[model samples]
Target: MPTLVKRLLAALVIFLLLVVINQYMSKEGLFGFGVPSYYARLIVLAGINIILAVSLNLITGFTGQFSIGHAGFMAVGAYSSAYLTVYYAQAWERSLGGIVGGSLAHALIFLLAILVGAIVAALAGLIVGIPSLRLRGDYLAIVTLGFAEIIRIVILNIDSVGGATGFTVPGYANFLWVYAFAIITIVIVYNIVHSDAGRALVSIREDELAAEAMGINTTRYKVLAFVISSALAGMAGVLAGHYLSFLSTNDFQFIRSFEIIIMIVLGGMGSLTGAILGAIIITFLPELLRTLGPRLESLLSSIFGADNIPASVHTFLLQLANYRLVIFAALLILIMLTRPQGILGTREFGLSWLKRARRRPEGDKPVGTGGVSIAEQEPPSAIDRAKEVKNQ
Candidate 1:
């Protein structure tokens, strides 16, 4: 079969699987099998974070731009899409429902909202990227940070989006929608990272001056990466808003941006899989920490008889839950200190990496047969040289 056909078939299979999983996650169980709401929410949020992390990685990791304003772009997408869905989605849904059933009409409206969010976010990225991308390192970071703060302040002042009260939106996003976009984001970033344009982005990251000298249009690529990143962040925001059925400016604060940065950094910069793994870890770690104390107590109770357990030790373990945040921070610090380059620095996890690891050295064997390699071959003796000359 053709590669395209195979890909389409694979996509179909995946979509079918997602549909089943979505059903299983719903309140009405799929054949009485279902995931708990707690886990469902975590998985959905992880998907959102994956989108954010992967998109940000395209610009910050692959393209070497330091943007700390992802949340700002997310806010733009969430609010813009929410506005449409709040005021116009019902009417559009009603009109389109007649043509394409209600279910699909609702989905179409959400898709339109996503498009609007992406476009608006991309515009914001372009506006910020053009002037700010000229500066490098700290200066660029500062500019982006300020831009995010400005956006938050602006949103707070806009009463239409509910300002301090927050905006309530319809729940159009679920596990399927969130993960679909997450997968799309990953594929888009992955394709770009492996393309000629991706090479230009990397070149700029390595040395902007050299890339400019080589006619790589460093600014153009940087801005492109930035806009694409922003657009994706916006899409994530739209999903988040719809999933939670609410939007608050406080949720898109600078701290949220830092959390995303931590995800990429902890996973390893310049690595797509690293970003994914990092996002998952960042999403789950806090929740896990919340239950750590009970888990530890249970383990100890099993190892040492519960009757033998010390009251002080039990008290300490129970109180551990209260300091989960501090412990979470400490764990993060420990990981960073130990693996500053991240768990996978500039490396990916896949079959290709395995193949590379098992490949032989060029000088370890002969060029074809079981003889010495060219670099290791012995020099010809005087008799061999004489024989060659006589034969010629």
Candidate 2:
């Protein structure tokens, strides 16, 4: 079949699959045990993580910049979006009274919040990227880490926006909003990566000095990558904040930044598909572990006798709920030490490889009207060619 036709068919199949899954969840529940709401939340979280990972991969993986303050940008977005939603929702409620209380107004407010969040985050990215990107490697990482902490502290002090006490946001984050943002994020990143600007970014990643020597403004591309990545991270934060319907300073912290970095690293940095896969796996793995924790505890109690089990064992098992960070850190260390190129490395999965593999099975054929094969008919050694020319 033609490539275009194949692509269209694949897209249609994906769309149908998504629709079927949505219908199934609506009817039979997402977890298959009648708890569709929880599964829906999980899917939303996975989408947000995928956005975070893929966007950050553009900077850390493609541009070779160590950004540790992505969560700060996310915090900026979340607080900005939350403030807009709460403030506007209240104003709309007061102005329109009962007319604006339904799903339509809520949907409008949610969109407004997303826009506000993205703009706020992009502005924050500009501020942070300008000064912090002047440094490189560990210095850049340290600056970003400090920036994130500063954002958290600032959020904590803002009383009007709930200050230290978290504020409740309207629960307008449904499957539609989450998946839409995720799709937009993915599409934007995909386009950017395939553009000339993306090539410049990759060149800078390969060698900043060389890129500069080639007349490429390395600083400009770096800042551009940072801004785009930060904006996407902010979008993810908005979705997450609205989904939870609550916002706290703790939600956007250094640890959150590290978690995003882990997703990018595990996914293979520059690979977009790897980013999505990594995000889904990382986001769902903790939930899976939580489910297993109880069974493991029960088995241990049966083996060791429930009465003899120490209280600390329960505490230890409970700690596993938060121990995802530990696992993430260990996995990162292992990757860095062994396979720093990541799971998929820098190569993208494409159909051209399959075509090339198929061609390889055909082997060599004889040249037309000659005993020589195609390979043998090629130019001889440079010196021999030169000697033949001289002799002729």
lDDT at residue 317 of model 2 (Cα atoms): 75
Clashes of 2: 0
Alpha-carbon runs more than 4 Å astray in model 1: 352-392
| TM-score against native, each model | 0.93, 0.78
Off by over 4 Å in 2: 1-20, 26-36, 90-104, 293-338, 349-392
lDDT for model 2 = 0.82
Could you give candidate 1's per-residue lDDT for residues 1-392 as a string of tens digits?
A: 99999999999998898898999998887999899999999999999999999999999999888889999999999999999999999999999999999999988999999999999999999999999999999999999999999999999999988999999999999999999889899999999989999999999989999999999888889999999999999999999999999999999999999999999999999999999999999999999999999999999999997988999999999999899999999999999999998988899988775554666686665673356566676788999999999999
Candidate 2 per-residue C-alpha lDDT over 320-342 given as tens digits, one digit per residue, 9 for 90 to 100: 76776577567668867897877
Top-scoring candidate (TM-score): 1
The lDDT per prediction is 0.94, 0.82
